[model samples]
Target: MDVSDILASQISKHKSILVEKDVPLDTDVGFLTVTDPSVVDKESYDHDREAYLQSTARDGIQHLLAALFSLPTLPSPEGPLAQLPPPTTQLPRAKPLPKPKPPTKWQRFARAKGISSQRRDKKIWDDERQAWVPRWGWRGKNRDEETQWLHEVPANADADHDPSKEARVARKERTAKNERQRLQNVARAQQGRTTATATGTQVDRKRDINRTLATTRMSTASMGKFDRVLDGEKKLRGVKRKFDPIEKSVDAEKSANLALIKQIGNGAPGGSSLKKVKRDGLDSESGGNGGAGGVVNVRKAVRFASGGQGAAALARKSVVGSGSDGRQKRRGKR
Candidate 1:
């Protein structure tokens, strides 16, 4: 009744699913990849390239699938599904590490002076307040005099001189200076790949700072009219107002303009026409107004020559010479 011989014949007809190698195949079922470290059979590969490649791929796939199936299966709606384990193989990062930020001007100075930075607490202890107050900003310890109700006036102080008012003014000035410095630092940082050791490049930095100062000055309320007057700053000059003759009628004005145009077009006493002279004058006045006939942009040329300071400043600079005193004065003015 036993069919052991028949069963043995059927089993022998099929190839075994198991695969063995010199080096054990590494399987990462999560990634569905198998690392075959064993050397390939050169003789078999050379004999049949396609067959060799197919067989190699087949072995890797079989190893990956076998590892996946070994995992414990959970019940699912359609069928049991085995969960893949986390990948063991380490992969390189797709992106490169970020570069370090360029150091600020203060940082460079600190480095040169061999000064190490120490963390300072934002809050400072006040003996009068009997509580911690901020070092700066929002009822800060720096504004102790300004916020206090009572103040002791000095014997030498003027009757109108209020210590509280003076203190408030001084605090405002201090804050403004700090903000200006911060803006200057930002402008310098924007200049690409600067080294801490360079001295010749400071003029370029000062140029940026001067522009920033001008922009911030206009940014204040009343278009910087009410803001503190900077030292050596030019006084506000009123524009000369002009008006056409009120006695002349519209018809007369049009006729007069036409007559003038006709006179100019008829040419001057010299051989050349007055119209050419007028056109030349206009072109000269246009400066860098993007006129097609403009050979050289006067504004850009002046800016480049004076290192961002206008023609008037350049004239003053030439007159004053390159002495440290004059240079320092120009910097302070900006």
Candidate 2:
């Protein structure tokens, strides 16, 4: 008889397998593809494959039975059929492992939000090395840079008051005016102290007049030619000169149009003014204008191509080149 006829006849003698009939005949035996040798060790599988049929132990016979059950037909007549014993071994029923519990609400929320659990629990930034470093919310060193709005807030005033919002805005405007007065007062106080330190009390009255005259002269020099300076351009003007709106408005409009960005609140975004302040070619390095002493030490570079010997001397001596050597010397001493 042919091998196909012999196999068909033998398979018909046994009961059908436990799986559903609608499952493809090929699919029933396909689970052998997922058998990883690493699970039961390669050596053990190889040993069972090569061992003598008579010497086959309990586990080896069990594996052989499993192979038989998974196959389509009983072993062939000449394929160890006569030597094999009747199938009596059964695999132990495995208890299903318990399912893991779902994560807590906070954990689920953090995962959904795409933030760390620890960060969600804590405030935005943590200070390190004398710098206010932000941990979340924004990526930049200056939080204001990331902000969309720049509300003119009153210095030292509460930002979140509803009833006092108009008053707060007015307060900020008043403060700006007050700053000019405060600057004048400070200049007068400094000049008086300088005179007192260098000369006798007899010249104190005379020194006051001289100081006022000097401040008036400085104020005239500081005022810019502009009628209105843009916020961006205004910030760029430090102690060197007040901003000139006439010179800066065109530049500010150009910057705003470069990027079509939306503001966050009522205020405008991007503080392009702050960015311009950084780019105005001022000496940004340490001790450029203002240092730890809260004093701006301005040193105009003397180009050797020009008649710079006099300028160089003035820099070295810390003297104002206005013929009053005694006052210059006193200013240097302070």
Candidate 3:
């Protein structure tokens, strides 16, 4: 037969063998057909035919051996392999790691032996009772209004009145008194007067003046000599220039005395003329010319007796009546 006829017959035989072995023949398994003579080369066709025959023979032998020995079938890629269990020899079981234990109280104490422990209790030292006291529990700091030591009674203690009770009663009385005083102050304020308690008595006034003088003396004593002199001069100036309504009455009294002195110096009756001058001055406020003239004469006489200068020197010195340089120097020496 020719090459084509021989190849076709061989292909038909292989097809029948595959069918008996239950191997499905698709495109990969070459089958010679009459209409396609150039499908595969001679060398390639021979190699493919050999491989197909070998694979089919191997599969048939394996199946026959399995059936004869009654052995389990080898796993296939799609079926047996997927349902197979994983190899135990490849992956051994792993035991869980052990847990670490916590530190004990003794270990903690050793770690913090040198450091101070944090306090949770509210106990404080009581100086009066000489003991430690809890602030807010039973027998706490606020159990009694008085201190614990103060509340303690002796074995021989008599049934005397309680000092704490007495203090409370006194405090209440003082509060009532203060309330009454406040009402009195309000009433006094409505009447346009200061509170009675605020008003100083004559004795208090005298005491205050004495205190002021004592303080003044003390302050002056503490000053330097030059400062003391300046302070004294300032005080003298203030006294000389200070004017008051009281001073006017004092001046009137002094003038009356001066008039009496003048009358006595002139050998005239003092009381009668003085009375007459005052009566006339009172009767006509604008007609005090006689009394004025008499005062001038008395002033001149007194100035002359004191070795004072004349009207010309008086005018030069102005109202202060400072004398000549010689007298001023003499007074300075004194």
Candidate 4:
């Protein structure tokens, strides 16, 4: 018998899914996105809606697969994987480009003098120390004279003059001068940034001055409270506060109530306070298992009276059994 013809007929029934569009699908291989600009057939879509939707989806998938298979593939353990090319689309940045930092005072001076800035190593050779030492910090070559015990006094020096004290003062002054210049540079850069408009510049300058003044006031012995108050000075503000704790959990309250019920059931001390609990069973949750005079649970009492038959079956025995939706009626006739 020729069963090959039957098998061939079965196989030919499902041909490759063909995608036909007016403008063709815009395929981005990098992002694996396909945009179809063709208009849908409303008559075909409205009639046989489910089949139409399935056909449309099948077309899209067929087009995507065709595009993917066209690309070169690399061999993998599972199968050959297509290598996606770089994206051709340019995307905008999430945030605006940051402003460049303003040049420092020394940087500007160096530029004016046509001097290229060069960074030197932190450690330097010292003649007196006879070893590699820091250029300008603790025990540095610059501070050798300040730490030296012996000093050659000048020819016309005062009797009470101290060489060590003089060296220390000079070092401190140099450091203070450097710090002052650094602060001035920072202030100048800020001023340049804030000077977008004349009125805005004045407002920013005043705000900066007030902030500096406030800092000085807070640095006082009494924290500006006992210090002499200047006219029109605004009071300092602290973080918002409250007496009670935030985000109190309900679980603790539930546990407390359960414990109280259990305690009263056990007949604990201080009976007067728990008088209400003893009198009433509170609710069905109590199950009437509290105190000497406990009200029985209604459901349990009914079950016992009916000899193990549930409430519903016992109820149906007397009257005509009613349907859950109340559609059933008297069964006297039909």
Candidate 5:
């Protein structure tokens, strides 16, 4: 036979048994009493009772399945398997614990009488000090005598005490004086003025001069004309003027250029006139020299040439006109 036919026959058998036993269809079999009058012995009754109870428990589960699956009656043992309710899709949410309320006087009293509410591990008894000390650690207890002395506070110590009125007034005066002095120093520096020393004594100018003379030993033998004059020394004749190396070199060049011009003026080539010689000399002197000194020398040489007005004009023109040539050369390059 097919599987469905077999299942149908088995179910029909179970239904027939249930009907012959005369069991109530709607009663919860698990709670039903044994009403059989033929049962006499207690053992037999108990045996029957246990069997019935087991059967009823099984039937109760089957009935629950039938109801959940929308069946008209209880499922037989051999009936097609029915699905169980999707086991508690989610667990019931737990409620939060209520907040603790503050202790009443009675609670506090109870706690004082050896019923501690707070954790007791924070403090412990210190054997050496004979005191209740913190569990974490103690500070400064094992320190040396010197360290204990340094850490000690005086009996009369008052950190927040105000100063006396007289002390406050004196401090204000001192601060004001310091501020005024600072402002005066700033003003002097801005205006390029020298500040005097704190003692207010006049500086000894003569003393400073005496000190310089002693240290430097400046005397008439090593002095210039200006220095000698300041020192009240008698002026002497034919004492070649003292000049720096640069000035000495410039003087030598000027003398050489003058000699060259004099030679050129005295002996010119056949066709070249005195004016032409003078012009040539000036041009050579100016070209060889540079700076304001060259322009001065050119003018001096021209005046000495005896060419009069024309020579002076030519000297002026040469000095001024050279700038235009330099500018024109720069423009041409661009």
Candidate 6:
């Protein structure tokens, strides 16, 4: 008993009302039809019939009326439409116009022969004459008064013209140029050969000098002088100087060792165990392993030397002999 119940009750009542109202048999024909059949007068009926005819006539002939009243309507043609004539209007024909007058005898001669003068055209305003005077010449304004330089064709010499003179001149110039170039090329080639032979001789001389230098041995006379100095130093009374080679070498070794120890100590903070092993390998190579390790060590030493002064200490201390103690440690003893 809520909104649905109310809606159902209203729909049921409206359905019955619609059923009764919609029955064809229950419809009132009397109310729909005119009550008096004679109520329409003859005038009214005729007027209504006339009005209907007028409305249909207006609706049906509206287009025809428009056509009849239209201005400038076109007429339809049969078969092919006649071709329209082309427009007569066209651009004006250009006139020959007036020709200008000549300036000098030479210019007139060149212009009459249809040759252009090297002189440029110049226009100047003449105050007295009230006209422009040109520097170079031109044809006159009046055709009849124009300078008559035109000539009639010669009867005898009109048949032949030859270009062999110009052709011969061009060929001569070309031949001269080619001959000059050929001479230059031959001179250049001769000079090049002489220079090459000179260079070869110089190179051969240098090679000979180097070979002689390499094969020649030092003289014992130089060593004999050094031995004399040593003997004199020993015999000198109370002038004993400690200039022993063995002592100098030992001192140098000790100094180098000290420098190496100093360098190792300075780099110890940043040094890795791997670097120590690499240094050991380098030592083995410098001692004359001469393998890949030797090459690597060479590169490393060069790089370290380039890096800073620390490499100087290491280089000074490093022994440059075969391995550490002059032994090829890996090979079996021979």
The numbered model that scores best in lDDT is 1
Q: Which ten residues in a row have the lowest lDDT in candidate 1?
A: 325-334
Q: Write the per-residue lDDT of candidate 2 for residues 160-193, one digit (tens) a residue.
A: 6443456456655766777776676666555655
**Model 4, poorest ten-residue lDDT window?**
325-334
Give the per-residue lDDT digits (tens) of candidate 4, residues 1-334.
9999999999899895667777788777787777677788999999999999888777777898888888999999999999998765557879999989899999999999999989988999987668999988877788788778789999999999999889989989999999999999999998887667756868888989988977888998888889877799778875587654554579866787788998878766556766756445454224333332335555575566446876655556434545432211111111
Off by over 4 Å in 1: 1-96, 128-131, 194-334
Model 5, 5-42: lDDT tens per residue? 88988888775322222443353223331232222346
- Better model by TM-score: candidate 4 vs candidate 6: 4
Name the regions of candidate 3 deviating beyond 4 angstroms: 1-161, 192-239, 242-334
- Model 6 CA deviation exceeding 4 Å by range: 1-162, 196-334
How displaced is residue 59 in candidate 6, in Å?
99
Report, for every candidate in turn, its global Cα lDDT versus the true structure. 0.78, 0.48, 0.52, 0.75, 0.52, 0.49
**TM-score, each model?**
0.34, 0.14, 0.16, 0.34, 0.14, 0.12
Could you give candidate 3's per-residue lDDT for residues 111-157 as a string of tens digits? Answer: 67855456556887778779889864566664445433476555776
Clashing pairs in 1: none
Q: In every candidate, how many clashes are there?
A: 0, 1, 0, 0, 0, 4
Q: What tens-digit string does per-residue lDDT give for candidate 6 at 1-334?
A: 3699888888887633111112122211222211122233457558798875564444334433333344243456653332333333344659865654324444556778999756444765545457776532352222212233443444564355323434446656766887786676666555555796778887999989865643332234553334334333432133368853655677788997898898887655457889878777676666654455565544354445435444344344344433353322222121
Deviation (Å) of 9 in candidate 4 = 37
